[model samples]
Target: MRADLDIEGGVVVGIDGSDASLHALFLASEEAGRRDCLLHVVRAWTLRTAPRPPEVPPSTVPSVAEFHDWIVLRTRALVEETLPAPEDRARVRLHLPRSQAVGALLTAAETAELLVVGHRGRGSRLMLGSVAAICVRRAGCPVLVTRPHHRRAAGRRATAGG
Candidate 1:
């Protein structure tokens, strides 16, 4: 693990602006609060790997600096708003690495107590995104992949309990 990647036994989570990733952030924050630990959110990006609009021209694509700024601005707000309590938000520490998601997440979780991620990211339509799949298989710490509750199942459970 790189010295900079050490989170001092915090909870690490990867966020990609996806609903699943947002839930993962919430779960990580809640878990971190429960454990009295920091919540480290990873937003990995690089020009080589950053997603771009299909219709955008190559020359008009956003540069790495632009991309970084966008992610920081957008994701910071998302993270801040997702956690319900101020104290929970205070415990969050963002990790913006200029690398691939899988590598960034694995390294960030090296010294963390747990790692959380979405089941699927924006880049993929499959049930499991490659990054989450690799992290689950290779992260040094245990990985928790978040999945949103199914509405029908939730309704059934709610009515059953009543």
Candidate 2:
């Protein structure tokens, strides 16, 4: 964590560069704007290494730092593209921590006013993603799991007709 960055009482959102995560980010940003609070954007990444044959040299694989940098860069690009408004970008503080997604989000949410995350992130097939589920269970503050727009619309239609 940076010396100047304060996660406490902020609106914390977990971002993974997925469309669902982006939706969560937008919603979190709007909530933060409404509350006049800071928006903390967090993205966690882990490096995976595959076993190499004895004949293979170690130089072929990218270093952990390289992977971390790539993730950070990609995340920043996604944020920039998704949040084009200068005011919206101004209120956000991005954190690209090289750790497990769940742990990072839980830590970020320790003192947050609210923890927001996508209902289902990339590669998630269930109704809720693992990170969002864990955050909802373990976060000290309120948690908002953002559903996909289509699903939300469908749900609204069902409720309105019922």
Candidate 3:
């Protein structure tokens, strides 16, 4: 995880291994490159439930560290897919925070020039996801909610087909 103190007037982006988030990352990278600033990629995770007995064994259940590791690995892959070139990757800094998505992103945006996130995440409903909505209303910096071009194309295709 990159230290928050290291971030200055850069672009902060929320990444969750979702397609929309990946698109946001791409945009954030472009913005960062244009500004000649670092692109901070943040992934926040929280344990949803405690391990229970009988149905689930403590040993069998993954630990918080394991979950964090998985998120980091997944986020890295997403970044790789978004930025194929080594030089483009060099401009990015990765962060994994153990907190809720909104809180983590809000904190990251405190000192950023711009905050970028996907319009929706893995299990979001409505056109504006809860996280994006909240961040737009409360983030310290400007927020950009990105929806992938392919998603928009699919939506248009569905409308035309119907």
Over 103-133, each residue of candidate 1 has an lDDT whose tens digit, in order, gives: 8888887788999999998767888889899
Candidate 2, 1-162: lDDT as tens digits: 222234778899988877789888877888999999989998876664211233335767766666766766677777787677789889988887766788888888778999999999887888888878888999889999987567774475366441
Off by over 4 Å in 3: 1-6, 49-59, 150-162
The lDDT of each candidate is 0.79, 0.77, 0.79
What shift in Å separates residue 37 of candidate 1 from its native position after superposition? Answer: 0.4
Worst 10 residues of 3 by lDDT: 49-58
Clash list (residue pairs), candidate 3: none
The total of clashing pairs for model 1 equals 0
Supply the TM-score for candidate 1: 0.81
Whole-model lDDT, model 3: 0.79
lDDT of 1 at 97: 82
- For each candidate, what TM-score against the reference? 0.81, 0.81, 0.81
